[model samples]
Target: MASDGSPSRDTPEKQKRKKKQKQRVEDDEEGRSSDGAEVRLDDDDDDDADEEKRLEKFAEEDIQRLTAAGHAALQSGDNHAAVKHFRSAYSYASKLGTRRVSKTCALNLGAAYVEAGNAEKGLRVLQRQGSSGRVADLQFNLGTALEALADAMEFEEAVRSLLRAGESYSSSGNPTEAALALRDAGKVMLQCGRDSSEEILNVLTNSLELSMRITHSETRGRILNTLGLLFSQMSLSSEAVECFQQALPLLSGNTQTLAVVLQNLGATHNTLGEFQKALSYHKEAAQLYGSLGRRAAQGRCFSNLGFALMELAEIEEARESYTHSLLAFKDSVCEALGAIRLQMREPEKAVVHFQEALGLLSRCQDVSSSVQERLVNKLSEALQHKLILQQRKAVAQRRHSQRLPGAAMRRPDVLIGRREMMNSGGNTHDRNQVSTEFHSEEPEKEDYSNTLPEANRNLNNTHDETDTGQQVISSQPENGPGEPSVECGKQMNGTLPLVSGTVTPPPGRHKATPPQRTLKSRFCTVM
Candidate 1:
């Protein structure tokens, strides 16, 4: 190295010193003094440290600002905007190595993704960054997102996610969330319809225990209801009844909840072959639903009530309940009947019912999108069945036409073909017209109960409590009785067959009459 009491500029040492001097000069210029002179650079190391600290602090401030913006967006229901903000916050907080901020931002990001319906993405975000003190909240959010994803059809994944959520919540000491998650898991397991009975029982048991510890009556009621349903599924009628009874008292404050409890109670009693009790429960539920202005729920209660009535052999009353409930559940009714008719080898009647159902469904605007889709799918199946029937009929007709020797050739052939086409077209037109006409009328106001036998009419007018504990109450008729009542036949499936005037029995069997006990139809469950 060359030197003038120092290393030469060409040497590595001299070159390093020159670079340092240039950097100091640049730094000094960057922070110039008032007199246009370079500032003293005594603590270069300290300045670098200060600069790094400032950068970290700025990053933290940005994360805070972003997180705040995300919350504001979430509160406004602008999920997409919230997701964007949270994503940015998460990135900044992560880069700065701030665990608390990063975790919070990540949680926010996942929830925003879920709210935006990007469930898979949300689940991924939570899974990666969700193992912290707030595990309970994160897992709950994850489970909910998975649920949404599963509804889009990833059932196994959703089940696993919900189980994970329950465990996480339990570990985090949040029994309430843990119980809810476990309950959801049981529901999902039940939906799968597999042999997961033991798992379901375990989860439901844990859920029940946790729910009992909570002070919330509604939550307790819901847990008890779910347990009752599970018990019913297992055919443990006594246990189911006990659970339902326990739930009923807790759910009294909420009309809809009380109605649901009553309906379940009715269902349980029906399963136990207690028709009268089931009828009583269903009637109470229907009245509650009516008071709450829940027509759909009321309709369901009526349909269930019809089932109890049929079991009790109250055919006339059952028919009336079925008709009333049909206003809301026509698609289900038609679909069931169409399927039954198809099974019975009555293709033509099945096709007619299916077509009528579709036409009526086209006018229904109050159903949920999911229900509408299901109805449309049923209609499609019905159309396919109708097509198959038509094809079979055409084939049979062609075979018959072939068997009849065509001596007159083209003339007879043309006449037969034309007639077949005309008949088919006419039938279709008639069915469509029937559908249109039926739709035009207010079906809810129509009462077919007037057609009951005179004996049945008396049964309707005065409450009858026989040894069988049957009860009946009649409402004011819209147009009074349409036709004069008839005397009933003996052994008419526990109903009096309609004929004119007084009741009479068959030769061998005696007429067994029950004592009248007039009670209002709308009896309260609480009373």
Candidate 2:
């Protein structure tokens, strides 16, 4: 008896019909296999055969015409037209009940959909065809579609699709294709940066071993580059450098690819503090990019070159390189200029450069918060420097006034007059009174020993009283040996904090100025 109030016989009859339908579907799928095997059927299969024959009679010609049109449209880059034709062809093949033709049409239709940027539809079509165990090409096409989808940011599904492709290719005895799919899957794993490190390593190891056995240099080079990037992410810089270098010769025929390897090598060397080697590689890359007429790429190379030069303390050359980079593209070079000027102790100039950098950032549509924060911090540092300079200037002026000699000491007449007034005293009490009056009338000399300490203490107190923004520039003295002493911030226990970063002018000092060039000639050279 059935759970519903229906007859049990009806349920049994329905199950029998479902069983027949299942068997027919199984037969159709088996017939679709690329390996041609004889079809087996039940005793009552004549009706099924007759039905399939009639469907084929009506749909066969239509499928052929539609498939041809689809191919033609795809070849001509009419992806929409190609998709339409392929869909019609697949529909006809499905109606005809020709399983092999239907599967082929499905593959073509999916590829067309993918070409038309309808990755979702393409994935669906390929998934439907790929459930059958022996469709290696279908799996391969699915992997291609998945990679395209991944390019469109469908990452998770792309990983699964590539893994399926790798498995399918391996089963079909194509090690190279299998390795290629696995390699791409490993790349996605790296990009995801999930906790699948062991799985990614296994995929990459398998791909690498298989790739080594193949004679495809381009593929091997690409694999090596991927490995290099992976190592870079892992902070294994030496190994990354080796991999990038090994990939270089293999990729030499491809200019764009070779330039990328060169740039990567340059960046890796820069990270390792090998500035000279980095400079050489960056210069070569810049030349290559120039030859290719890729302005943005050339600008990037110039910017990298500037970074290496700045690390080497070649500030002037770095500044020039940064200027060239700016002409090509606006970037972080203005901030770099601020840092350079700050290092040179030119606070006013640094402040100007920082303001320029901040203004540039304000105009950008996609400014990152971290970059803005860094620039703001830099500006704060510059302002603090300016304050320190002002404080030091005041202290210097006070020291200058204390050091100046009175003209009375230099004049013989004034000295003689003072001596006569003391010598020609009327009495002992009168002489003592006269000396006391002279001493009281003259200005008392300040004890200069405590001057530096008092100035530094005042400066420190002022700094401490300022807001959080001023604290970005450290006012605390460095405790380490060989650390450069900061003005107004050095240890001031008993000994005075030495006021540094200033040169005392010699007696009768005159500033030496360089000859200036005309604006027209300088502009011409810069241009």
Candidate 3:
């Protein structure tokens, strides 16, 4: 012990025994400390495992509670509240490390954002969660977000997203959603007004095909009706009618929808010139609208009914229908009524109606200049017709007053004498001289010369055209054998030249050839 380090505590033998005892004591203390540490470590591990399970259970419950609230909020139309609840659910699910529930919550969050009109936010949420897989619901919500962003996106991008959504739904056995997505795509194309008709048709047709798989009659009917309207806008009247007819029976339980289908059918049939069918459909639609207390819609239906009746030539029925429209509401039907009146030759009534329409239009803020211009033109036309009719009446009244009883009695005898002279082999010169003497002698006879000039002047002042392509005011009286008679106020090159209202001789008597004037009857119809 004293060899180099420290002083010895005991002798060699006794010290050996004492050293063994101290070593034993040190070993016992070390073993006891190790055993205590092991026991504490085991207790800590068990507590942590139990705590993690408890936290996971709480997180799952919270996620479920939040998801339920989000769904309830969405159904109640509180999209903002839905977004809040869904966002919390998503956070809880993420914290719990649940991939499946996390995805579900993400989808809910995105849909809530979309419904809230925050499409950009929804799109970002969906894109983040959609990276893992191709999900039908996810794709559908993504498409909706894209469609809502249509104003901010190019047409091609908007359409491509919708198509992808539709395809995904189709592959995932969700025909209804697929159909809706495709239908939306078709609507986008139409609204863009840039796609070809054929392309739009193909897209709509695919939607229709998918819609046929739907078991719910009302939903299918609505889809079909929407497609029908799109077809109508594309000018596919035949296909549109077919679609409307198919939807009519399916949607019979829904009164408003049924009425709309009937109205559409009526309009399409009218466009196809099937006025008889159109009249029936319009009547049914009008009655439905009346029952529904939709006064404005009923008025529109009656107006459409009037158009159909007019096309069928049922003038009285058409007029009655138009009156019904006017009673329901004072709309553009006034102009239509004016047109009908014009067709019936009631120029005074037409003028009144036209003026009323112009006044009504003036009061409306949305009236276009072109519409006002057309109404003004119609009023001018009615006025011109009224003036012509007044002139004719005045001329007829003057002629009636100027006629003498003696001249009327002598007219037959004069005509009989002229006929006898002509039948008795009179020479051309003698016949002409007799005609001249007869005309010169009968000064009291109906002298058209005085009234003709005024009538011709009035005719020349108006810009109206006859159906014959020329406005013939009056015919010239028969002239002598050497002179040729000419028609008065006939138009050449569609232009009416001013004349002195006097009959002029032809350039060459014997060889004079007059232009052939064909008299045609003109008929006016409602627009």
TM-score of structure candidate 3: 0.55
Q: Is candidate 2 or candidate 3 better by lDDT?
A: 3
Worst 10-residue lDDT window, candidate 2: 518-527
The TM-scores of all predictions, comma-separated, are: 0.50, 0.47, 0.55
For residue 305, give model 2's deviation from the true position in Å. Answer: 1.6
Write candidate 3's Cα lDDT for 208-302 as tens digits: 99989988887678777767766766667788789889988998997777877787787677767787988788889888766654443555567
Candidate 1 segments whose C-alpha is farther than 4 A from its true place: 1-78, 151-161, 193-195, 230-239, 327-527
1 or 2, which is superior by TM-score?
A: 1
Put down candidate 1 lDDT per residue, 92-150, tens digits, no spaces: 97898867777877777877787777878987888897377676666566666776675
- Output the number of the TM-score-best candidate: 3
Sliding window of 10 residues with minimal summed lDDT for model 3: 518-527
Write the number of the candidate with greater TM-score, choosing between 2 and 3. 3
